[model samples]
Target: MKEGTVLIIGRPNVGKSTFLNNLIGQKVAITSPKPQTTRFPIRAVYKDQRGNIIFVDTPGVFGKAEDLLSRQINKKTLESIQEDIDLVLYMVDHTRRRDFEEAKVLGIVRKIEKPKILVINKIDKTTPSYLAQYKFLEKEFDRVHMISALKGKHIKPLIDDIFKFLPEKKGESEVDFHEKPTPILNIDSKTYVAELIREKLFLLTRDEVPYTVNVEVEEITPRSENLTYVKAKIITTADRYKKMLIGKGGKMIKEIGRLARKELELMSNKKFYLDLEVITDPHWQERIE
Candidate 1:
């Protein structure tokens, strides 16, 4: 059976997270319209009759990582690339122009000696096409595929190609599907819940508030068979940002909690009482390790 690791790399807002989520047929990463929504590399397993594959979804590489958070995120992505990976999927958004940021990511991709595939995403958007600009990469890579990750278009063929390049496993599989509790590796239940809250903050907040904020799930208790109680906090850089998140009479925070709770219930098929609060932490970004 074919089995190996495939790493997905791209620039910010190119739909790398979306592609990973769709490819796994589940949400192991959080996504947003905002760039750098994915803070770190997420490892998830994908299994089928052919083989078991480990997929690493990495944070987008920034052209200029000015802030502490952006620099850390960029560092994490570059570090993931240095690991032992069997194949690489260099994903790009054809609707966007190929500029210096694209060049920055491309430069990294060019250094990799392993098998690579150029995946041009967002083919569903026809007008305002920058398709011609990325056409030159076709000759550079042996395989290229145009897909719309959001619409699940042409994904099957992409999977077929990915399997073709994977190395065959000679003995018993390292991962036993029946014994594995979850496909996602590298994160616990609390971290997953925290990410859900963070995603809501990204969707509901404006400007720099989303980037400045981080979520922490402190306590998760099962009060009953059908209900789970969760306590969480949102850490921000300043009081003004905290106020903005709280909004007038706490309208904004309430909306964020309501939306997050709805999604939690939908995914877990149980009730969740999320105790969410926002606080000011001037050095929150610096604390990231």
Candidate 2:
């Protein structure tokens, strides 16, 4: 049996996360139709007669990281490319015009020593000629696959061809498709906290504010019924920003807490309390070493 890991990577809004869901046939990651919806890497095990592919959904490669969380995400995404990845699924949204980052993506691809397959996604919005015209990209990569992950068109051939190119690790030969165990990769605890707080900010803020707000989980306490107390710092660059987050009469913060806590309960399957506070720092996130 062929067995290894595949990393899905590309620019933001390229439908990388959506393609991951289609490949794994599960919704292991959330989709918001927004950029940067995926904060942490999510793993979904794909097992079939041909092989088992552990697909890792990574945050889309974008702007240079200015803060701790953004820096960490970019660092991790690049680091995954350096890992023992079986293949790299570089996806581009075919419906939209390519951006400057497409040049950046080419640079990154040049640096990746591993074998890669370019996938042109969002074909549901294009004509055959639109996809057929990417001869330049076809000449650039060893191989390319085209499909709409949303509609599941031409996915089986892509998956079949993907396994055909994998370099199998030792002990994989002993594995059986029916008997091979599926890997249930869970989110890292520390990263989970950061994502929770970031998601809370994404839910609460508007305009450019959500992008500016960076959260850090400072503490956690365990309690009965599997409850865990969480305290996070909502860091902003100015006192005015902090005041905006806290909202009028503190109502905004309260609402954020209420909404986040309810989602937390649904996620943890336990009751827990939340204490949300705001802080202003010239550059708390600049503390990144």
Candidate 3:
């Protein structure tokens, strides 16, 4: 039996979040079409008859850090990968060639001195020639695999390879192998609630509205045995955005809240009374955590 941690790092919009969700067979991380959707390292567990593998999904690496927030996100990505990891999965969009960002990311991976796998994601969008272009990378990596994360193609072989490189464990488990996989991190209810709201915010709004907004869960209280009341404040960069989010007759805010409430109910298995408010806070992202 083998057991260890795998750290996944990649450039922005490389499908890191989608890959993690597909690998784990659950939605442990929130994903969107936009870049920078993931801001922190998300931890999940994958177990089988052989052993258990702890997976950490980190924020996407970008070439330029234009703001303090981007710099902080980059720091978090590096900090997670530098830990005592058993393996590193460096994913790249198969449709795109190696560029400056990929070069920079590889430099950091080299310094880690751990066994690494080069994953070419989104192969469904590319042709055989595109895949062949990266074939030379096989010699540079411990192992390389091309996969379509969104479509779940060629994943079983990848899983086999992932477990093969992990360090072996001593004991055998008596528990049933059919049992469901569990999460490794102690996930906070408020944190995920906030994240779900932010995800919906990204999907509902366009352009800078999503990027310039942040969700703050002000209160979560249990009002009854199977009922909870949640109050969240959506912070926007300007009064114009705040009003835009509110929309005429409060249409936009209502839609966002409605979708978020439905998801929260399914996740918590409880009835929820959700109250949403939008406020202008241009420096919300700049505030020290």
Candidate 4:
């Protein structure tokens, strides 16, 4: 079967998952307004009567001097498009300035030797004054098309544009709606870890705690029939933050576990034993090498 992969690379909180959900007409990835909500490269395989396009939604890249995990995320995001990226979709905020930080990410995208599409999201927030300066915005992104992703604007044309760039489908693979073949309707490993942590942080932590937290799966094993155990570490840079995660009488950790376990059981379709631990390991911290 003929296949092609589309890499969605952009900064944090730019609506990558939302954009993808709109494209596939399904909720495969968890969408939250929080930055770094998407931590993994989620693959949504869409097979239509025309062809199949594998969309890889990646973690948002933010250039930070403090969090090591964020640095790793940005590194991994760049690595996604560095290899076999058939198309690179770079999402930019139509309402924001091209600061040095955002420019850094764009620099990485500029290096990708593939067809690049600039998806300018959040145009619904724009005014007539903003529209008057649209041309000025266009100059910042060379050969980029502007569209409001949240309002479902220009998405069809955008998909059409993506299909145009994709290599033709050989028509060998038939659509298996019963089995739901071609389009992958599940979140990947990176996404699962990210969502578990994000949902917890969003609920438990306030202020900077939610922003600084990162979750990684240390181990996953199947113990017996219809049973699986997930060992994951919730990482933070500070010991005080660690205390916060544990909370008063370990209430915080328990809540996080309960929520994650419930979601896992629903996804796994089996009994799940989720063991969650908090770590202050600087390995995935905010600092750069």
Candidate 5:
């Protein structure tokens, strides 16, 4: 059976996370319209009749990393690429024009010596397309796929093509699926829960609010067999941003907590008491190591 590691690389909002989630049939990473929504590399495993594959969904590389967070995210993406990867999937969003950001990501992808695949994502969007600009890339790679990750179009064929490049493993599986309860390997329950809350913050908030905030889960305890108690804090850089996150009469915070709680409950098959609050810490970005 063919088994190996695959790394997905692309610029911000190019649907890298969406593609990984769809391929695995699970939400191992959080995604949003905001650039750099994925702050770190998320490692998850995918298994089928062919073999086991480990997929690393990395943070999108930025053309100009003006902020401390953006710089850190770019560094993380670079670090991920340096690891032992069996294959590389360079994805691009066709709905958006190819520019400096795309060039920056491509410059990095070109340096990888492993087998590479050029995946053109968002094929469903035809009106505002720069598909012609990316067509020239087809000659550079042996395989090119046009897929709509969100719609799951042409994904099966892409998976089949990926296996063709993978090296065969003749022995037992490397990952002990019986011991690992979830496909996600790099994060614990607390970190995953924090990410879920952060996703809500990203989806509900507007403009810079989502970018300026970080979610931290202070404590997660079982109150009873049917319920879990989770206490988390939304850390931001300024009091004004905190006030906006809290909203007038606590409307915004309440809604964010409600949506996060519902998803947590659905995932765990138990009730959750999410004690969420907003706080201001001017140096929160500095602590992002």
Candidate 6:
């Protein structure tokens, strides 16, 4: 058996989280179409007969950030590319035009001495010529795999190839694929619960609202063997945004809570009593600093 750590790096909204969820065949990470949807580094374990792949899904690598939150996110993303990693899965949205940020990321990746593979994601939304745009990437990496993380295109082959980068074991024989292997992750319920709420907020709210707000889990109390109570706060920068989130007659917040609770219940496999509140704090992100 072989084991390795693979860091998934890319600019925001490139389906990095989506790829992680698809690879593990579970929703270990929350995802949204909005840029900067991922704010922290999430780790998940994918195991098979070949070995195990511990994946680190990072925030999108972007150029300078004005806010303290964005700065911290960018720093975390770059810090993930460490010597301890066995392979780097550098993903890019094939449909978008390459920009200065992409060039900056490419330059940093070029200096890394670890083995890496260029994964061109979102191929389902592009034409064959999309490959031409990223042709330069082929020369920089040992191999390239074009895939659609959302549509689950060519995911199995991508996973198979990822195992090739892991350290090999002697006297290891291939195991039966029919015997399902259980995937594992070291994520806590509180963090993932907050992420689930944040994902719904992003999908429900409009421009600037999603980025300005942050979800914080206050408590997760087990009411019974089969039931749990979760209390969380949605922190925002201003009162107006809070009003918008709450909506007239508290309809908007109710919808957000309803959707988030449903997902959390399914994820926890327990009845969840989700208590959500929106608070206005202009320096919510900075206060953590």
User: Residues 142-224, candidate 5, lDDT per residue (tens digit)?
Assistant: 69999999999999989998898889985876777888765856988889999999999999999888989999999999999
Clashing pairs in 2: none
Q: Which stretches of candidate 4 lie above 4 Å from their native place?
A: 25-31, 65-67, 127-153, 170-195, 216-231, 265-275, 284-289
**Which is better, 2 or 4, measured by TM-score?**
2
The Cα error of candidate 3 at residue 168, in Å, is: 2.2
What TM-score, to 2 decimals, does candidate 5 have?
Answer: 0.97
lDDT of 4: 0.71
On lDDT, the leading prediction is: 5
RMSD of each: 1.1, 4.4, 3.2, 4.6, 1.1, 3.8
Per-model TM-score versus the true fold:
0.97, 0.75, 0.89, 0.73, 0.97, 0.91
The positional error of residue 207 in candidate 6, measured at the CA in angstroms, is: 0.9
Candidate 4 per-residue lDDT over residues 187-242, each given as its tens digit? 55645654665676676677778756777776677899898878887887788989
Task: Choose 3 or 5, whichever is better by TM-score.
Answer: 5
- Per model, how many backbone clashes are there? 0, 0, 0, 7, 0, 0
User: How does residue 262 of candidate 5 score in lDDT?
Assistant: 96
Clashing pairs in 3: none
TM-score of 2: 0.75
Q: Is candidate 1 or candidate 3 better by TM-score?
A: 1
Question: Taking the tens digit of each residue's C-alpha lDDT, what string does model 2 give over 153-262?
Answer: 87987888789778664663433545633434555554566666666667677776665566777777886657788887788888878888999999878887887778
lDDT of 3 at 163: 95
Selected candidate, larger TM-score, 2 vs 6: 6
Candidate 5 clash pair list? none
Task: Give the residue spans of candidate 2 off by over 4 A.
Answer: 21-50, 63-75, 126-136, 149-156, 172-186, 226-228
Better of 4 and 5 by lDDT: 5
Report the alpha-carbon TM-score of model 3 versus the true structure. 0.89
